[model samples]
Target: MDTLEKEDLARYNRQIILPELGITGQEKLKGAKVLVIGAGGLGCPALQYLVGAGVGFIGIVEDDVVELSNLHRQVLYGIADIGRSKALAASEKLSLLNPLIQIISYQQRLVPENAEMLFSGYDLVLDGSDNFETRFLVNDTCVLLNMPFVFGAVFRFDGQVSVFNYEGGPVYRDVFPEAPSEDQRPNCEDSGVLGMLPGVIGSYMAAEAIKMITGIGTPLSGRLLVIDLLDNSSQVFMIAGANPDLKKDKEKSGTEEAYAINLEQFKRLSDLHAQRVCVIDVREVYEFEELPTLALNIPLYELLTAQLPLDKILVFICQSGSRSRMAVQVLKGHYKGEMYSLGTLLFK
Candidate 1:
């Protein structure tokens, strides 16, 4: 083996000493190109360790701005970075951590239109995006592109990680072919997540990415790992691939009844009456105290436990629109009401 260069030797001293990595694996890492989608909590650790370990080319794609709320687990930015672009901030920080590695930043949301072209350029894609919409978008785009991606998600104290589309193995869609409808989904913002959950899951994704690149131990293909911190329990399930393609039933879209109208429309509805339409308010009792509406005051939990009067056209309203969306699912079963979430009724 050739003698290691000074900087190479110093940068990867620990990894170099390992019999598995040696200098050759280190070089493989140096030559690899990785694209991480979404530079939020999950993106932070994935990028940090990848750059620290000498991934030669790293691309970050995120169009979101840093917010005060992100400081809990993003770990890449400080309070000073609030209002800045997330991808740009992550790229600059990763650049400083290891100048030897080149950081590429795509400060834009990955859409169906651009996903195929952009994902084709990288050896591996890492998914740390928060919502089901983005997850479905990224996973489907990966399928069309035939590229492999590491997937991670944190919900409350629970997290899951797995590798998708490897060595002709199963893709994400093979496991979760469909996303939960908007009414069934809950975001971290309202539903809540423990601070360390994202860190653990994101770091696991980085490790898997490194292993996949260097051809190390058996990766998490055809398997799912779920971790629950509060309960201190972990579950692993072996799954079979069915190769289902949702495009066969393409042109899929969410129901109009699940649509959340803006506040103006809600106000206009106040004047215009629908005797059969029931306005459902999901905000907690405390919030309703401030700007009370005539909508039926049903907390999300109450709506779930008790039977719903779904026969009426239901207009779901919340502090924003998140909780109200959850209510629509339960109401859908009881009645085929036209569900509209009044999250658009903001700041008024």
Candidate 2:
């Protein structure tokens, strides 16, 4: 194990003064290796705090370039860094913040092919990915590698932080079994977000990492912290361990309704009543490169005014079932037809 030097002692004197995290905890942080998934909103703040804490080794994985839009939240970069690779730019800035630690930059996307190899080298992973596909991919890969990860996500005025797969605790899948496809909903770019929201969530993610590394406070394993800036409130929810029937339990508890059915049920409806069954896809036109033959494209926003066959059994579909459910609700009394929402169980 590597020990902290005299300069390190001075740099982390404030935190080291804590009764729980003294010289020994500082040494643990000095020896820890943490890999962050993105250099966007959440990653920027988390990286800065972790670097300042003297984490010995840190890796940044990002394929995006700095854009003018990212300036509000990604404070690590300046106007001069526009168009620069996020991983490289963040690495350079973090190294300047703490030259004593090592920073590695992987200017590439975290795809399935490279995920396992990259994840195997780190003691822990901190996911700051924006998309659900990447987030779920990270969780699955970490579970396969038997590694724990800190998860953070930010929306317009809301954010969430959690520690998953730690000490045999609940993983991301335990809480969210399914995710919407990329086209299901708009991202921060489309929906807009509060500039400082990621900072709050990312700081929590960094604190969780530090606590896990130093063995100081209790990590958020099996617990999720949700922050809502709009209401100026926060709440922590406990996550149950992996259960194959978690989704079923949710549906049984009335979280999901009878109007929501799986793909198999949708297919059966289409097969049994071919002429009477109609599938309406409530995704944006941009989301589809080529529309599926089975469904008609009707973006959620235009669904209310769209013409539809009143005699047909309507099945609404989207990247995730969220918008589809909304569609069903919107057309319930208006459209005199049997309606169903094919949630995430139905894919492109």
RMSD of each: 11.3, 8.2
> Each model's TM-score, in the order given?
0.68, 0.71
Q: Model 2, 222-332: lDDT tens per residue?
A: 666778798787765545323336546776786666687887887788889999988778766656444453578896646666788889898887665656766775675
lDDT of each: 0.77, 0.84
Worst 10 residues of 1 by lDDT: 242-251
Q: For every model in order, what is the number of clashing pairs?
A: 3, 0
Q: Write the per-residue lDDT of candidate 1 for residues 91-162, one digit (tens) a residue.
A: 888888898889889988988878887788788899998887778888888777777889999878888899
lDDT winner among the candidates? 2
Candidate with top TM-score is 2
